[model samples]
Target: MKDKYDVVVVGAGPAGSITAMYAARGGCSVLLMEKDRDIGMPVRCGEAVGKDGLNGVIEIRPEWIAATINRFRLVAPDGAVVEPDIGGTGYVLERRVFDYDLAMAAVEAGADVVTKAYVNGLWKESVNGQERIVGVTYTWKGIPRKVRGAVIVGADGVESRVGKWAGIDTTTDFRDMECCAQMTLAGVHMEENACEFHFGSRWAPQGYLWVFPKRHGMVNVGVGISGMAAKTRKPMYILEEFIKERFPRAGVLTTVAGGVPCVDTLREIVKNNVVLVGDAARQVNPVSGGGIAGAMQAGKIAGEVIAGAVASGDMAELEDYPRRWEKLRGARNRTYYRMKKAVFNLSDETLNSIASSVLKLPREKQTIWGVFRTALVKRPSLILEMARTFGLKERE
Candidate 1:
């Protein structure tokens, strides 16, 4: 790699790769680094992404999709199921292939891509009594190397060290982190176009169980529980018990365990010459524990902002990153975080009653919000609090 570049992005996931692609396309010299030997090895995601969320970002390859989902089955504690048709379907992708393809796109766009390069920390320098990021020091092939840059982008995951090294507060509390365990199983009987979600404090306290079908009768069954629940019992233990009881005849293929940040956006994500994206910025959906779409969207914006700053030689232009992201995604994240807190605090009786009401609605209108509103309508105080918290009145 060169001694210096216009921009250096850590991590080669969707966010980092897209940032590199956009920056390079805008005519900035860019370098994208990944610690893993392979671009997408050791996958840790549920692998489901919305269709519209990825359309213009990257072209979808037929071989990368395991299944296309159009319908949802939301199951309550009492086994009450609400089926709904959600248009603009989603897909469970082969993340390994998908990640590599995204990185290749960045390389094709003129960014240099490197793997097995671990970033130890940010190289900081003081310019005129102010701290600024100058470059990164990392170990590659067991040798230390330094690359200087005018800008750095942290596209790292939830536990991002780059942000911390750059003085950005990237800490997430246990309550905001979702402990998850998933297993890909064969011989599982499931509908190809239907995704199942099981909700209950018993099944997955503070979170939910999901089943996304893959090709050839294989399915990815997973559960996410709040860190509080996980402290009492391991998330894998909860998942194992549920699977043994529900799918006694299924065969396991692969297992994965990881944490998902279900918190609101970080208080700050950009500083000086550096910016944070993807889970590093806590941009994942607070309710769904999904970050693919948010990461890609954030990467696109960060890329444009960084490119402008590099071209203009103005550090002030970099400050626009957080403002743009907040305008687009901050309110939704705040609303979802509140909704998650409320749902996790519900009693089993309340959940059952909500499920019954939800089942009474037509499939098209059977949403979690509908159930929440129906069950809590009698308590006008609670309704009003929710309305104010989510800015629902403005939406209405």
Candidate 2:
């Protein structure tokens, strides 16, 4: 194996694989590394992704998908349900197979992939009294090896060490983190074409529960709660209780528990020749905590920027990657973050009142945004205040 490469991507998740694919295809020598023995073992995500968000990035194969979705059901506090017809609801993916396939795409694009490689820390070189990233030192198969590259991308999941090693503030406050727990269950009766979401303080204060149907008469049933709420009640206990009561007849297939960053996108995701993408960049949506699409979008932009910088012999151009991601996701994140705060702070009575108002709306107008707007309509003063504070425009 070569001792060095033009680009080294840490982590083999969606972000890293996509970045490696684009970089290698653009004529840059790339090395993609994964700490785990497998690409997507021990699945962590809700495994749901929007179809529109993934278009043009990669083609979705039938084998990679468990089921296709066309509708969504939002269950509010007091068990009031709102069914909305929407396009591009997305698919429940078989993440283990899907992730491996993505890494294979990178390899096919001319990048080399190494698994069971753990990066201990970054390798730095001083040029003109300026500390610059030159490579990374990692242990692969119990043997220490060092690989150098012109650029390093951190696509390591939510708990990323590369970003911190590169001097980026990757700390996420408990108030801004969602404690998540999920289980794949069989023999569950659910709408295979419709994804279900249960919301409310009691159900998951500051977060929600999701039912994403998959193949073989199974679905991924999960709950994500704010860390603050988790302190009072363990997330696993909550999920277990919900399953016992709500899904009495279902049999568990697999269990997964982890945390998702709910903070708004970071202001700085780039420095020197290093760049952060995916969870390392805090690019997940604040409201939904959904990151698959956001990661792919950022990866594409990062690849373009990195390629340009490598070709120009000017590393400063890499800064544009973070700026571009901010431009694409910052506004929506800011809005959703503020909205999440306000929504979580609402009292049970207030939520029930909002639900009642939503029930009054015509069935055709009972969309998610419509219901949210209706709930906030009565509190015009608060709405204007939130808009001003969050720098959001008042949308009717």
Candidate 3:
């Protein structure tokens, strides 16, 4: 690996790879490093990406998709189901293939890529008597090494040490941190190409349970419980119990356990010559817990901004990265965070009431806002938050 580059990005996930791709395309020497032995090994996500959002970041490839989801169901505590009148809007991805190709895209765009490189800390030096981040210290194959860069972008996961080292407040509130467990279950015979969200104390107390269909009959069954609720019973135990009750006959293929930081965007994402993207910057959608699109979007923005700043020799341009992110994606995440705060605290009875009310809507009125309206009826104070969250306008 080179000792120096114009842009040094840590992590080979969607955010880092995309950042390296765009930076290299913008005429910067970029290095994309992955801590894992291989990129996209041991997938951790629920693997659902919105159709338009994913397309906006990268051209959608058929091989990247595992299943086309055309239907969405919100299940209530009392077995009530509310179906939204949504068109084809989602896809469950084959992330193993998808992430590898994206990193390859970055390499094709002229970024150097490496694997099994673990970044330990940020290295800074005095420039004009002011300390500024200049590089990173990491180990490759157990050999210590450091790389210098004009800019360092941290695309690490939710527990981002780089961000913490850079002095960004990456701390998540106890309630905002979601403890999750997921399993790939086979021999399940429910609806195909349909994603279901199950809600209730029996499923996931403050968080929710999801059944996302994969390419085969295997379904991604998972449960996310709020940190507050996790204090009582662990997420894996809840998931195991739910599996026994819901899909008792299904065979378990794989299991994953992790934490998702559900906080909105950090107050600061860019500092000096150091930057944070993806989950490191808390870009995951609070309500849905999806981040592929948001990470790519942030990566692109950060890459362009850092490249422009380097090209112009004005480090001040780096600040534009966070502003653009806020305008393009962070504001939306903030709205979802507020919505999560409201919806996550609802009792099972309230959820059932909302679900029952939503199921009674006319076929034409069965939309996201339709369900929000039903929720607003029970909790009247959610009108403004709901309006902002759903982008609802004045009555026609």
Candidate 4:
């Protein structure tokens, strides 16, 4: 690896790889580093992406997809259910292959990609009486190496240290955190073209449980509980118990555990010469804790901004990263955060009632947006909030 580059992005996930690819394509020397020996091994995500969201950033390749989803069910505690079409499309990705392909794309775009490289610290220097990160120090192949860059991008996941090291406050409140556990199971009987979500204190305790199809006869089932509730019962145990009762004979294929930040986007994402993206910047949806699409979108913007700065030798351009992201997604995410806070407080009976109401709607009208409005029945003012955010008439 070179001793110096224009951009150094940590964490070879979708966000980091896309950032590296775009920056390199923009004519910046970029380095992408991954601590894992394989780019996407031991995947930590739910592996689902919205059709429009995915297409907005990258072209969808048939090889990267495991299952196609056109509809989803939302089940309440009382078994009241509502089926909603995702506008006839979505995909559950084979994240391992997808991430590896993204890294290779970055390499093809002129960035150097390295695996098994763990970033241990940042390279900082005193500038105008302040410590500013100029690069990073990482260990590759059990050997330490230092690389300097004009800009640094931290796409590390929720447990990132790079942002903190760069003096950005990356702390999240326990209430806003969802402790998650997932298992890929075979021998499960579920719709191969649909996904399922269960909501109630019993099922997930303030968060939600999801069952997404991986392929025929295979499903990814998981639960995300509020951090506070998770202290009382492990998320894995909760999911396992649910599975035993729901699909007793299912065979486990793989298990994953992690945390999802379900809060409003951070007020700050850029610090001096460094910028945080993906989970590091809390870009995940505050309601669903979905970050794949958000990460890729943020990475795209960050790359363009940083590359422009590098080319012009004006690092101040980095500030555009957060502004652009807020315009693109963070603003809507804040509305979702408000909706989450309001909905998560409803009684189980209330959620069942909402589900029942949604079920009564015309199939075409029983959309996610309809579900959101149903959830806001008690907090009707939030309906106005949503309308304002989306430029919809209050009646709509």
Candidate 5:
């Protein structure tokens, strides 16, 4: 809207909105742009968020939630099952509403927010023999426009052209990408207050399948398969087949397909005067492929760091973005990456064995940590890393 601002954030998803909101609240001029006509149209997520994780970054609103979850059902190949208290609240969000509200929050915080504003490229200039991004070029409401800023934030999703333009390598390894497909179904019979996870080659080879309640009698059923596994079968086909077998009479209401970066945080997130956040920075949980909560947290950190840099007129302060992020989640995500590798190698029989063992315990003793501990029965050292990362004792 304006020709210039203190911060220009691309992709008005959770990360961009949060970054813009905080930066504006911190007294920096901020612009949040969304390429799509609607701020949160065509949702591309599982739409599930852990209570503590979401509340840590933003307040929870009942209107933005679809279902409240406090427990999880885990199903192994042999159909052995265990239901564990997720330890806190969980919510399947009405993402479109959630995203729109977040963007409005940014606007209320004094950031200019716009939709249908396609950012085509970055405005880069050379300084001291090195190129740096100073702003962005976009088509706002079908009119070509350019805006300048002291710092740029790329909250673009999996296909991050802004990061590419800023010379921040945003590519995820083929093997580390998860090809995902999800469909919201009506008239499905499942626990309304619980989320379910299914595992095995027959269900979701090289990845996991999830069933999350959206509303009473309605659920979002999805499957994420490793990029390697996708080479053999389509994720959507797998999902459809499972739906026919599991919820034969249910009606498909909506379908979504996308990729999730199942890798550790990028080695570099901030470069020069630009920083990458959310899916652009590969901030999703390496083990679960969940990015909503991580994106919010990363956005908050980036906003504060960029605001300080703007206040002092010292671009060098931008470097604190990555350092602060590392302290918050980067280190723990690396541990999750290793855990992903270890879990991926486990055989179907092994998973069933673990599930059986977990089921044998008293209902209350069959906890999420107990399941994690069973997976690391061989690599006890990795258990230490897991314990430290999760703030749980190894014995738990």
Candidate 6:
């Protein structure tokens, strides 16, 4: 749209939109681009986000929410159920409306927004014998256009090429990747205020299956399996079998498929004039594969950092983006990664045995804390990994 701007954000997802909003609020010309013709089209997420996860970042709007969850049940392979005291902490969102509203907020804050803009390459400017990311070349409406900027934020999804172009390693271990498939179905009988998660190798191989209520009779049923297992078992067939067994009468209204990077955050999120946020930075939770909240949080940090750098007339200030983010949540994220890797390595029978032990406890002991404590009793060596999961030192 313009020859140049102070900041050009690629991918107008939550991370990109939030980055644009904050950067513009901090006194910078920002342009947000989306490859899709409409923002939030073809929703690929399970759409369940916890209330505490989004507390300070975004005020929950009534319209953006489809269903509110008060509790959740964790079902083991033997059908042993453990209900966690979540206390109405989660909500299923209408992502199409939610994402559009987020981008609109960015526009209202003085950032330019464009859809159907596909970024094919980055614009590099060399200085002192080093090439730096300066801008991007994108196709808008079947026409090639070039836009230059002092800073570029790659808010693109998991298959992001921006970071790769900037020489940042965005590689993920296949075992750390979750191949996911989701379906929005109607005529399902389920607890309206509770989400259900089923676990076991039979249920989802190395991952899990979730049934999040969208409304009273509608639900988002999904499964996430390890990418390594996906090589042998097709995700769609697995999902179909699970659905048929659980909800034979359910009619599928919509189906979506995607991949979630269930690994620690990328070590380097910013390089020179370029920054990566959200999935591009692998900010999804290693344990749950949840990323909406983390993406927004990282976007907020990246926006402020980029804006501060622009105001200070120092390009080097962008390097602090990842540092500030890690200080805020990355440290805990790394811990989760460690725990995820350890638990993921556990045999399915081991997990089921652990679940059975927890289920035998009283209703009061069915909490996540209780489950972990029970697990520690069986495998004392996992204590350190569990400590790391909570950001606690092993010595403590």
State each model's CA lDDT, in order: 0.86, 0.86, 0.88, 0.88, 0.88, 0.88
Residue 222, model 5: Cα distance from true site in angstroms: 0.4
Report the lDDT of model 6 for residue 325: 88
Candidate 6 per-residue lDDT, tens place, 1-396, comes to 678899999999899999999999999999999999999888889999988777777677999988888888888777877888878778989898999999998999999999999999998778689876678998999899889989989899988888988889998888788999999999987788888998878878888899999875989899999999899997788899989998999999999998999988998998878899999999998889999999999998899989999999898898888888888889888888888866766666667788888878888878888887877886776776666655676563
Whole-model alpha-carbon lDDT for candidate 1 = 0.86
Error of 6 at 361 (Å): 1.9
What tens digits encode model 5's per-residue C-alpha lDDT throughout 297-334?
Answer: 99998998899999999989988889988988899898
Residue-wise lDDT of candidate 3 within 346-387, one digit each (tens)? 888888888878878787787778887789897775676566
Which ranges in model 3 have alpha carbons more than 4 Å from their true place?
381-396
Q: Write the per-residue lDDT of candidate 2 for residues 273-341, one digit (tens) a residue.
A: 788889888888888889898888888888888888888889989988877777887678877887777
| Per-prediction CA RMSD (Å) | 2.9, 2.6, 3.4, 3.4, 3.8, 2.6
List where candidate 4 sits over 4 angstroms from the true fold. Answer: 127-130, 378-396
Per-residue lDDT value at 294 in model 5: 90
Candidate 5's displacement at residue 81, Å, is 1.0
Instruction: Looking at model 2, report the run of 10 residues with the lowest lDDT sum.
Output: 378-387
Hey, what RMSD does candidate 5 come out at? 3.8
Query: Total clashes, candidate 3?
Result: 0
lDDT of 1 by residue, 1-396 (tens): 788999999999999999999999988999999998989777888888889878767778998898898877888788888776765378988887888998998999999988999999998888899877899999998799989989999998977899899888898998778999998889987788888988888788888899888889888899998888888978898889988998888998889998899999898888888889999889999988989988998888899989999999998998888888888787788888987776676666767777787777776677646765676863455666676666567544
What is the RMSD, in Å, between candidate 2 and the native fold over all Cα?
Answer: 2.6
* Residues 249-339 of candidate 4: C-alpha lDDT, one tens digit per residue: 9999899998999988889899888889999899998888888999999988999899899999998999998999999999999888876
Residue 132 of model 1: what lDDT?
72
What TM value does model 1 have? 0.93
